[model samples]
Target: MFIRAESKALNEAIAPALCAVSAKNTVAVLECLYLNAEDGKLTVIGYDNSKGMKTSCDADIIESGCILVKGMKFAGIIKMMPQGEITIATDERNNVSISSGKTKFEIAGMSGDIFPALPELVSEKGITLSQAFLKKMISQTIFSYAQTDIKPVYMGILFEFKDSELRVCSCDGYRISFCKAPFSSGESLTERFIVPGKTLTELQKLLKDDDTPVNIELTRRHIVFSFNGLFFFSRLMEGEFLDYENSFQKVFKTYITVDISELIDSIERAGLIIDDKMKTAIKFIIYGDVLQIKTATETGKIDEEITAEVEGEDLTIGFNHRYIIEALKGAQISGDDKIVMSLNTPFSGMVITPVDHEDYKYMILPVRM
Candidate 1:
């Protein structure tokens, strides 16, 4: 392939695309990125048989050709090159040459025709959402995604749509997060699809936070996200996501309203003493208006009391301190406001929300550290 492109554009194109390249693959071609030069444009493609990415940029193409270059080697070389026009060409012997300014580098490549084809998406349902809204939904819930190999279905986030609202839910059996966004116009439909956390995370990194709209198209087995001159595809996790909404049917035994920052700080400070093997067991003891948060380990213990407007009888609940801390941080807490935590039991879901806004709710189940 013979192509001439600016260094910055080439680097931008490769940075996000290379993320899907397999670091350890049985198939040698999966470790390489396909570079195609055609019709005044250069396209870089990378995939590991499951997730894939494609990005294109305008370039001066002297000859139309295709080559597959090692992802790591190509990325490293391009990153170190000067910020100017770069010339890349592949010879008949399969040697790829890269030149910019006065420096030149050569590397071997495989024929691009041998690279596996990226999955072709068949869109049965499609929606458009603002980039900022999509980013928020991903950030608020993605951290709680399942990672265990036993249930491959749980290792992803659930996407649900109804009328003009979209919701993203994620959980790892310990805690669950749900975030919703408004869709201005769309057919009234309710469909649940599970998407791996890694895919949403990659989108979060690439999607801009501006007001641009992003198009999301989905079929039975795959999903495609096109935004900001980037195309991302991910294999959907098959099987049913556990029924999350049913957990909210019961009432909480105790409800406490405290500052979000205050509770987060207390969890962080108290969790330090709870060793990993012991499950970071931090206890919340509520008596009248005083709420005490404490944790103990073999070597040390931390205890702190925060005044809260508590309701119902006194209760003490044990929970994973790290989970509570992270959950508190994820909630969309408002300025100088008290956040409410409605607790039913350590085994049940605890609903959290800012006192000022009822539109958003965060639920996290207590871990029996």
Candidate 2:
């Protein structure tokens, strides 16, 4: 393919497409990226058997053709090249010649005709949601996703769309984390599916903090995301997601409202005494108008108190301070906002929600003292 494009723009297209490149394969056609230069546009495509990505860059196409080059090698060459225009051409022998202002290089490439083809998405309705919202939802919940390979279903984040509200939930058995974003109006996009945590993570990296709409299309076996001239495709897992909504149906006997930063600071200090080996717990001595965080070890101990607005009965509870800290960070709480904590007993999971909103919910199971 004879395509002359600016090095900066070329790299931008290559980088995103590499998200789907098979890093596991040391050899084979899967190691290369498909480059098609035609109709005044240069499109780069990469696909593993499961996921794929395609990105387009504006280029000066002198001759319309297609070729495949080692994905990482080609990306590395472009990455180090100067910022000026770069010309790439593939001859009949499948040798690729790439050069910019002063430097030039030639490399072996594969014929694009033999590359694996991507699946054709069935004609279905597409849903549009903001990039900023999707990014926030994933960040707030993905941390709690299951890491083990035993239960493959738990390794994914659930995308639940029901009654117009989208809730993303992740759990590692010990805790459940979730966030919600409203879909203002759409052409009846309602369904539930699990997207692998790793896939969500890669997609999150590409999402900017803007309000740019991300178009989503899904079928029984595959899901596609398109935005800003970039296309992402991922295979859907075959299983039903956990019933996350049922976890929030419990009755709460105690509710405490405290400053978000103050509780976070106290939890941070309490976590200092505990490490992975030590396995310490932060005991919460809840009583009239005050919440105390206490952590003790053979080496040392810590105790911190902060004023809280408590209602219902007073009780002492214990929890892993790390969960509270992570949840607080994910919730993105501010000074003006208060944290609402709900509890039934020391054995039940403590629910944490930010003031005046159901946008996010964090749950932490108590650690027995």
Candidate 3:
């Protein structure tokens, strides 16, 4: 393969695709980026069997061919090259040469024929939404996904489309993050799938916060996301996601509305004295329009109070500090925005929702103190 392209354009195409390339893989080709130069463009692909990303950029294709080069090294070389044009070529021996104005380097490459083939990108079942909306939905829920592999099913975020609404949910046994928005596909589509958290994390980085639409396609076993000349696909997790709709409590004995920033600051202050190694729980005493936050450890103790609009029966509850902080932060609340907290018992999960809308809900299991 021989191609000439601007360094900036090449970096833009190669950088995002590297997210799918594993640093070390048992399959040698999985660690390499497949470069196919043809038809006046250079297409770069990185696949690690479970998920993959492909992107293309305009290039001067001297010869229509393909080769595989080490993903990390090639990306590094392109990024560090001079600001002008870059030329990449390969010989019969599979030796790859990358050069800029006054510098050049040679590296070993493998035939592109050995790289794993990506899944088919077309499907009849799919939805199109603005990149900003999808990015926000993923950011709000991804925090609750399981970080461990003990429950493989919980390690992904669930995407459910029904009744012209799309709901995204994630749970990690201790807490649940849920967000939904109205979506009209005109086809009355009802579909559900689970995408691995790792895939969404990388996708989030590439997603631009704009009005550009992202086309999502779902096959029997894979999900594809296409936007701005980039194709990202990941294998869908097998098995049923938790029935999250029914898990949230509908009744509450205590309700409190407080400023989002004030509450977050109080909890973060309490977190300062609590050590992760001790597994400490922050105690909340809510009564008479005042919420008292308290926590103590060998390091120190904190007692802080914040004003709130309290209703129903007053209650004292305990929760893992980190869980509460993460849940609040994930809400994407801003200044002057208030959140309502509802609780039934010390053991029941605390449900949080914005004071103005019900579009997002976060539930955290209370710690037994």
The per-prediction tally of clashing pairs is: 0, 0, 0
Question: Which parts of model 1 are misplaced by more than 4 Å?
Answer: 24-26, 333-336
Model 2 TM-score, 2 decimals: 0.89
Q: Using Cα atoms with residue i matched to residue i, what is each candidate's TM-score against the true structure? A: 0.94, 0.89, 0.96
Best by lDDT: 3
* TM-score for candidate 1, residues paired by index: 0.94
Could you say which candidate leads in TM-score?
A: 3
Each model's Cα RMSD: 2.0, 2.6, 1.5
Clashing pairs in 3: none
Q: Supply candidate 1's per-residue lDDT for 177.
A: 79
> Lowest-scoring 10 consecutive residues by lDDT in candidate 1?
329-338
lDDT agreement with native, every candidate: 0.83, 0.86, 0.90
Badly placed stretches (over 4 Å) of model 2 are 22-31, 63-65, 91-95, 107-114, 277-279, 333-336
Model 2 whole-model lDDT (C-alpha atoms): 0.86
